[model samples]
Target: MKIAIVGATGLVGREIIRICEELLPHEATYTLFASSNSAGTKLKVNEKVCEVKELKEENIETYDISLFSAGGERSKKFAKSFLNKGSYVVDNSSAFRMEEEVPLVVYGINEDKISKETKLISNPNCTTMGLVMVLKPLHEKYKLEKIVPTAYQAVSGSGRAAVESLKNEEKLGEELKPNYRDGFYTRPISRNVIPLAGNLTENGYSDEEMKFVNESRKILDIKSLIVEPSNARVGVETGHGVFCSATFQKEVDVKEAIDVLNSFNGVQYWEETLPTPLDAEGSNDVLVGRMRKGLSSNKILNFWSVSDNLLKGAALNAVQIASYIVQND
Candidate 1:
């Protein structure tokens, strides 16, 4: 069998290559794809040095599975081409997510939504994936009425440019200064927190914030689920952290909530020390802690969670979808 990795030269794309080697079948061959600028570059995948090909229709070939993390626009343009050639496409972009027919999936949560006839699957936004892993089981125990999620997202979630911006600002000693303005982001990422994490929409929310709201509703199958999300880009390098307060129909039991979270497949509930972004780097599990009843009501529960944005959030989830297809096929 053959597999394709699109965006092989990118941040998440390179992680995907590393995971494909670790998780996929030993015999499955690898092909890497990138834009013209990265084309002809070499990357080692599955112990073989492969040339990164240009992502053009003329260069395409049929493969068993294709994993995409290029970007939304590129996925929209090229993903169907892979599907037409009979490859199962697991996309890590906003492209097909929210399409009425497309299945937006989180591996341990709503992955059962994928099926035999499924041609393309979507990985949720990095922060949303971490948020819902905590919410899904809690919702099962106590029907979730509303959610207020405040995110401290790592710069790595934005891309290599954002990460570089953080590093560059720190190196230039601009971040330590009172007034520092030059970076790829609107604000310097070092020694700072930027409230504007994405493009502003007419509704006064960011595209990233809206992704959290809408994607949560879709993944949980709750059309009217209330999600009040506020996101910020933090100086951290890898993990994304979310603090959530949820109101439910049933009163929350602190002990029971901890057990429920710990028992969940992809979640690790912490008791003594609250999990931090530093702890989540390179880990697959979403770390949850600071569980307690909300100040005002027993029906409300507040908790904090952290996860590696690149792994469980993006590349790893895409590869898991491919694994699910392979195992179930």
Candidate 2:
């Protein structure tokens, strides 16, 4: 099998390569592609060193599958070209996610949505990926009526520029002043949390928050599900932590919910121990804990979940999709 990774020099792109090396280690041939500015930079796939190539339409046809981590605009422009050439595209951008024709997929939750006929697949936002992974099993056991999810997302979700900004702010320590006009973030991110993540929409919800609403609906195939999302940018360097309170249509038993989450694929749930971002940083599994009954309703359930935003949220999910496609083929 031949595969190509677009945006090869970016943060998620690099993770994609690392995962591809670890997962599809033996047989697949790999190529790296990035923008002209990043082209010619060297990157490693397993032990072999390869230089990044410029992403172009002509070059896309050479691979059987292409994993795109470039931003939405680039994916909008180039993804179809790859698909037109008969190469399946697993996109990690929000580009075609809500498109009626495109399938928005989470590897374990709804991978069965993928079939031989699927040519273009959209990966959910990092926040949505972790939320839906834990929600799916619970939703199956007791149908979901509503979800209130507040995310403590890592700076890595904003790409390398935001991560650099945090590092620069940390180096300056207490002396660091807010550069509201100059930085990529709206406010100082180091030793701070920004309540708004992504741009605000007309409805007052940030795009990142709405992704939790819309993408979860699509991935879980629940069109009428009520999702209220509060997405925040935390100071952490990696791993996204989400605290969710859910209302189910039926009465929920805490023990039963814990069992369902623990047995579910791609997720780990514990009763006595709780998961933190540090535990999730390099792991593929979404960790869930701190399960308890809601204050007001017996039907309500609350829990905490954490996962590496770059891994399970983006690169690893895309690679897993590609692996499933290959295995089925």
Candidate 3:
């Protein structure tokens, strides 16, 4: 299949190219798309070099599949333009997620929502993807009542600039520059933890936190499930960790919950084999372990979940969703 990756020079886009080269046996053609500023740049796929092109409505119509990882503004403007031209778009932005027509998909969770008529598919936020991979199976076993998740998100989740800023701050000392007002983050992201991501809505939740609440409900088909999310940026490089404490509607059997998590799709739990950033860095599966039930609360369960924010969190999930559509439809 011919694929065009919009924002192909960005971190997630680059990883998508690498994954396609590694996993796909078919000789697929890849067209890389970037903004006007990055149009002339060249990115390597396998040993071959492909020049990045500027996205145009006419050019976008040429590919069978288009993966969009550029921010919302670009997606909002050009996503439909590509789709209107008869291309399937698997977007990694929050732009069209809540739209009724667009399916917000995690490949193994709700991939069946995609159909031949579906042109635009939205991939959930990085944290939401990790949370749902662990929550979906558990939700099926015992209905969830509430979830309190506190995340130790890696710096890479912010974007390439934020990761570079952290590296630069380490060499130039931990002093905030007037010009460098945290371009992709809310506060000083070096040697410090930022308690928020995105803007605070009128309801007092940041856009990132609200994604966990709303997307989980939509994916799990469980609205009115109380989700309290506290998102923070840590100084790590890759892999996001979530410490989740969940309350179910009924008394959950501890062994049963563990068995369910062990059997869930998109989750890897080889306790002896460590699934860190080094292992899951470019893979599609979300790694979940350290699961335990709260002794005090019969309804509560505690666990930790982790995944490479660039892959399962963004590009790989988008690709898996596309693969599912192609196979099922």
Candidate 4:
């Protein structure tokens, strides 16, 4: 396979490069693409230093697949251009996720949705990807009815600027004020938690919150499923931890639920080896643990799920989708 990674100089894009090298089948060639500003920059992929190339329409038709994490606008502008040229676009942006034509896929949960006709497949939000892995097995057995989720998302979810802000803030000592450009977080992300993530819409749900509610339904194929989520930003470098309480259609057997979750792919129940941000640091699985039943509602349950935002959340998911397309098609 010949692969091209767009946004190659960004954090998630860089991780995609690492994953491609780590997961490549023995016979494969990789290419790195970035904006002109980063064109001459050099990156090390599988021990070799490769220079980034400028991304232009004329040069976009040379690869079999493109994994993108640049942002919505860049994807909106160029994804179809690549797809039209027969390059499968596994997008990591929010742009095409909800579109009727695009399939929002999480590799273990719903990889079969992919096909040759599905040119631009959207990867779900990082938080959604981690949560759905745990939810899918339970939903399949008990039929999830309602969910209340609160996310303690890390600074890496905001992008490279937020990661650097925490480092700079650590040097100075206290929580500083937000300085628009260089500081990626909208508010001071140092020693405090920010209640907001993404833009706030008319319904009062931040775009990040809506992604959890909306994308969960799409991935689960349950449009009427109720998901109440509070998305917040915390001062962590990696890993988005979600504290979720969910209700099922029937009273779930706690032991059976636990056993089923333990059996699910990408879940970390039986093996202590399941990756966390540090273990999943460069890998693809979502880590889950500490499951319990709500004392009051027979149908309700609680659990914690964590995943490296750059990997399971973005890059790895994109690559997994691309790999699924190739194998299944």
Note each model's CA RMSD in angstroms.
Answer: 1.2, 1.3, 2.6, 2.5
- Report the Cα lDDT for candidate 4: 0.82
Give the whole-model CA lDDT for all candidates, comma-separated. 0.90, 0.89, 0.81, 0.82
Clashes per candidate, residues 3 or more apart or on different chains: 0, 0, 0, 0
How do all models score by TM-score? 0.97, 0.97, 0.91, 0.92
Worst 10 residues of 1 by lDDT: 173-182
Top candidate by TM-score? 1
* Candidate number achieving the greatest lDDT relative to the actual structure: 1
Residue 227 miss distance in model 4 (angstroms)? 1.0
Clashing pairs in 1: none
List model 2 lDDT by residue over 67-128, tens digit each. 99989999999987888778899999998999987889899887888876888999999999
TM-score between model 1 and native? 0.97
What is the TM-score ranking, best to worst? 1, 2, 4, 3
lDDT of 3 by residue, 120-182 (tens): 899999988988898888888888889999887888887788788778766656456544564
lDDT of 1 at 188: 74
The TM-score measured for candidate 2 stands at: 0.97
